[model samples]
Target: MTVLDQRALNRATLARQMLLDRADLPVADAVAHLCGLQAQEPQEPYVGLWSRLRAFDPAVLSDLLVRRRLVRTHLMRRTVHLLAADDVLAWRTRHDAMLRQRVLGVYRGEFDGVDLDELAAAAREVLADGEPRTNAEIVSVLAARWPDPDRRALGEIVLALVPTVQAPPRGLWRTTAGVRTVALARWLGSDADPAGPDGDDPPGRALVRRYLAAFGPAASADLRAWCGLAGLPAAVAAVRDELVAFRDARGRTLLDLPGAPRPDPDTPAPIRFLPAFDNAVLGYHDRSRIIDDAHRNLSVAGARFVLVDGRVAATWTVDEGVVVVTPLRAFTRAERTAAAEEGAALASFLSEGENHRVRVAAG
Candidate 1:
């Protein structure tokens, strides 16, 4: 019945995403609250966390990886996400079908006539010994059984077939290492939670709730886009009674947890630096709330952006100890000052305080 204009949604997004003000939550709690950071770029989560959490320590995240409290896994749209180990275990089984389908979408011809269930079992066998293996290594072992299939295709299918974690030294802070994966169970010392016997509630119902918590007042399509799962309509239906819905200006129905934060439309938002693929911009079907439609591609293009007034206003990069900002729109003196302050802090964090130089490029 109520229409949430873009600015209203923008400020709400900023509040829910911890960008409106830096939060002092613990790193583990922050990871859980944000529903996990997009972590395909291993070092990027450190920056992502730095922008949100107050007094964030890079070692705390590294320790999470080493301690198995958090895991770098292929989940949620098949991207490598640094998720809470408990969340991954509870949600991984529900994502299996979507994961398999997505990989097939890209390599369907290559896997024709190959029984996927059989492929899954074989991939599990290869990974059962507890040794971490690269995608190439796993694919090579399976080549004997499916000799004609694309090796890359086979490798990707193996990841989809099994609950796997990209092992440490890869996602560890400031560490550059090749991806080596181990079974999620082995690495976390816990088994995937099995779907219940009743099957009354679907696998993704919890995901819908979690998504709303972090990226809520969103449409069903946005939920699907965020998780890459198509079967959640039933999950949403199962929980429809528990959610409240409103229509956006476009008449798209948005779902929200009744009590979640929806900050005032006029709330002042600070300039914050976001890491590449940060979900605050990508987790919506309609991203106009946080990024202009024209610049939407930047979120997926792996371009780190600067948020000014709760919207993307500049693109940033690092060169020779300098954080360079190229504005998409002319920034006012105050916005430029704010951007500089955040950029300098980001530079120090990126270079471990060895450099804090930031340059705002002429618009």
Candidate 2:
């Protein structure tokens, strides 16, 4: 098998992630293409889409939320993600067990005697009216039935047990609002699709394909890392015939869709700004393809990064409308110029073309 070195994997990642060249796709399609944007931070998806899409209008994303075309929900890894409504409805059921287990992992002792099925039925009853409710609001009502578990734990398990979407304007572009959730089925006007019989897991198989399309040439471990589902080995096995294989430098088996873009290792990677918790860095078990080992913790620490030559080279933030870039390492004069130029573009995007100032801190 061909051994894909780090640079080879880096370029491939860049291509698959649409960071090598911005895509002209529409906002919802791009969201679907990327699976979804990690959207715990409400305004960050706008910046993420801005970096990937050409002429991305934040209003379109907000409009999608209002129109029920896009939704914010707990899906992969049980984190808040901005997902296409159709994808969420189709994939939400598949994640039900994992979501329950993850919340339990965090609050197991708190839920010792609580019957989760009963809790779910009750929670559904609470949400059945179709009115959006904040977590605290939902939990206060449920606190009467299950006063044993910590309120936080009780609320989290309720959300996991009952598939729910965080309602807008929680995720609306440039809008600051508290999280209010409604039942996923009620919000989308359809129940989440049930798993296929005999444990076929067609959605799991579809996820395997989709992950490779966007983040692939990856290992089974990487796929698991991306989706947080432990049972996809069966899914991978079912689809094994559909994929091509390669080996990473570490000798781990890598899989990819045959026709997916794997650009040349030396492809010129422009400086691109990424949002906190962006999956391009967090989607894999091994992130060395796009981030250095020394800086690996930054990916999970919610630091927005600047990609210099397709690798994380700096962390960025905005202060008083200025895009502030603090280099993680020394940059060449040209790299600095490119980063500033791109940072300016991002600032302008954030400010709606009012401010484009960028400060690249000394080396």
TM-scores for all predictions: 0.97, 0.99
Model 1 alpha-carbon drift over 4 Å, by segment: 196-199
| Superposition error at 78 for model 2 (Å) | 1.0
Angstrom error at residue 158, model 1: 0.2
Q: Encode model 1's per-residue lDDT on 1-363: one tens digit a residue.
A: 889989988888888889999999999999999999999999999989998989999999999899889999888889989999899989898888788888989996998898988998898899898899988889888998899898888888888988899888899988899999899888888889886533465556788888998988899999988888777787898888999998899999999999999988998988899999999988988999889989988889999999998999999999988999999999898888888998999999989989889999887
- Candidate 2 per-residue lDDT, tens place, 130-234, comes to 899999999999999888899999889988999899988888878889989899889989999997743688898899999999998999999989999987888
Q: Candidate 2, after superposition: displacement of residue 191 in Å?
A: 0.6
Error of 2 at 327 (Å): 0.6
Clashes of each: 0, 0
Residue 84's C-alpha lDDT in candidate 2? 91
